[model samples]
Target chain A: MNTLGISVDAWAAWAPGIDSPNDWNAWLAGDSCLDEGVKPNVSFVPPMYRRRLSLLGKMAVLTAQQCVDQYPIDSSLRLVFASRYGENARTVGILNNIVDDGSVSPAAFSLSVHNAIAGIFSIIHNATEPSVSVSAGQETFSAAWIEAEQILWSQMENADRVLLVYYDEPLTGDLTRFTDDIQIPFSISLMLSKSQSNGESICLQNKRALDSSDSSLNESKLNQPLSFLRLLLSPEQMISTTTSNWVWVKNSANA
Target chain B: MSDLIQEIKELIIEVLDLEDISPDEIVATEPLFVEGLGLDSIDALELGLALKNKYNVSIDAESEETKKHFSSVESLAAFVTSSR
Candidate 1:
């Protein structure tokens, strides 16, 4: 089977609500909170492309643009976007209006779909590339990454490359409190190529889930994105049997 | 007239998440883009939605003239007042 090596091209994160680790630590203790300056508004985004976008849309596009700028790729490359909760803010906002005022904003209604981010990306980038968005609840992280790897692996038979972008922002209101216990706002993109790695390579190792009483699987308190992130980006000393997201396979420097 | 501009300035500050900007510092004719306020395209989209929600003004974003209206908070307020 043909395998593809993936490397991190660019990652950008913007967290609106929390300003410090102390605030984030408080969130881990299960607190329904709001960050004073975390809300996404239009002034932060530029004017030429600001005519059509939501808060979530802005974040996704910015991260994707960052990736494109960092690594110049063919506009025809395939892409995969994954997000858990998938536009829950727009969902709840529409639901609130329907229940209270019997009306919904047209933009909000359209953006409520799961593929909205992918669609927006295709437009802003002016790329007619094939793309798909995925939402698999708690299994979102593993499923999305695995799918991207599989796509790259398949393309490697023809020596093709693909980009995988993973992004998720916590929803506003009380629901965020019930969900992510940490304020881990992040967006990570991995550009997978049939070519060999330069030095830092990320390897996706598949292993059987052991029968154990792990708090992550059982408790709703664990934030999957943050948990997976810590393990994925952890240093060698930080590696522990307790965490198993993915192992980084390091080899040579590009230079 | 200054009061209306001040009010619009406050609205811009609130909607755009401008942490350090004060209403008094925003001049009426200063550019709101790269030169003055340094807002980008994404901020325009979000703040446009916010303006619609707050003032009940119909922002025909599909039109090209909307660019001139967003040049400054003064123009935006004037546009809103005239449109109403």
Candidate 2:
């Protein structure tokens, strides 16, 4: 496919010990690292609904809130929430409960679904527009971006913006044996629009022409979201991230 | 009976994740669901599970009596006592 053009109207990210832009810049410079066992404070959410959100959900919602705060969208906003392994900790607890006594906490079960965070966000914002939840293995972020891009491309008249959120946490228990991706609990939210006139223009191209065996290409230790965040925060012209099947090249339009 | 009421109040605070509310602040006679604590139906279900796990009490989710038992800390304490 040709390089699909898009613009980032606003962005926000959160992880333990890394919240502000300065923190992210320091992290990219290898001067700081994400602290373990620290959770994002989402006190803005009312107590009643906040109780239902898992740590991952809190990260997603918090970043999205911060992004919107930076650039408020007055037009209809569509949301695309992406997570590779969403709420696995909560789901594991529910499964253990079922095995132990054939009973589960109703609230835990309710919030364990993949789309539960998206549901919570829609309810909290009273956003009646269409929303989608996605999980696509290693290519989850790229998939979500493509989904957001498609939404903007197809529904430009009805909706001018889409909030793309990606969040995940380290796998626990036996589930840790599944993959070797970075285990940090982090979230990135980007407000994307089709209008190229405003904000930072970027393009995503599927790297089919590039040789898959190129020795110069290095795999990033950080996961896709963090890698993309590094690219966004840095002055780099382009960064290539490889998933299981596809290599995605993100380029700054200015470069 | 008051000890059981306090225990249930703490349990409610713990199970429902009422982080800001202290046990002493929860009036035993006040409604636990909407109009008082403002908890919705999901809280009721979660509280029922906690009660079942802690007190081994069977809650008929659809029964009017279950609603009565879940109305307040006092009512839940009475239900647990009777069940035991």
Question: Which candidate leads in DockQ?
Answer: 2
Instruction: Write one digit per residue (lDDT tens) for candidate 2, span A1-255.
Output: 455677887899998989989998997777757786677899989888898888899999999999888766454788899999999998888888889889888888889888999999878877777889999888888889889878888844477888999999988766889967878788999999884643356666655566567654445556678878877877665556654433345444433
TM-score of chain A of 1: 0.69
Please name the candidate that would achieve the greatest TM-score relative to the true structure: 2
Candidate 1, residues A23-84, lDDT tens digits: the string is 44455455645454465443444443454456666656665666677665565477888887
* DockQ, every prediction: 0.06, 0.81
The RMSD (Cα, Å) of candidate 2 is 2.7
Model 1 misses residue A197 by how many Å? 6.6
lDDT of 1 at A41: 48
Model 2 alpha-carbon drift over 4 Å, by segment: A73-75, A197-199, A209-221, A244-255
Fraction of the true interface contacts (Cα pairs closer than 8 Å across chains) found in each model: 0.00, 0.82
Q: TM per model?
A: 0.57, 0.90
Question: Which segments of model 1 are wrong by more than 4 Å?
Answer: A1-5, A16-51, A73-76, A156-159, A174-184, A195-199, A209-224, A227-233, A237-255, B1-84
* DockQ value for model 2: 0.81
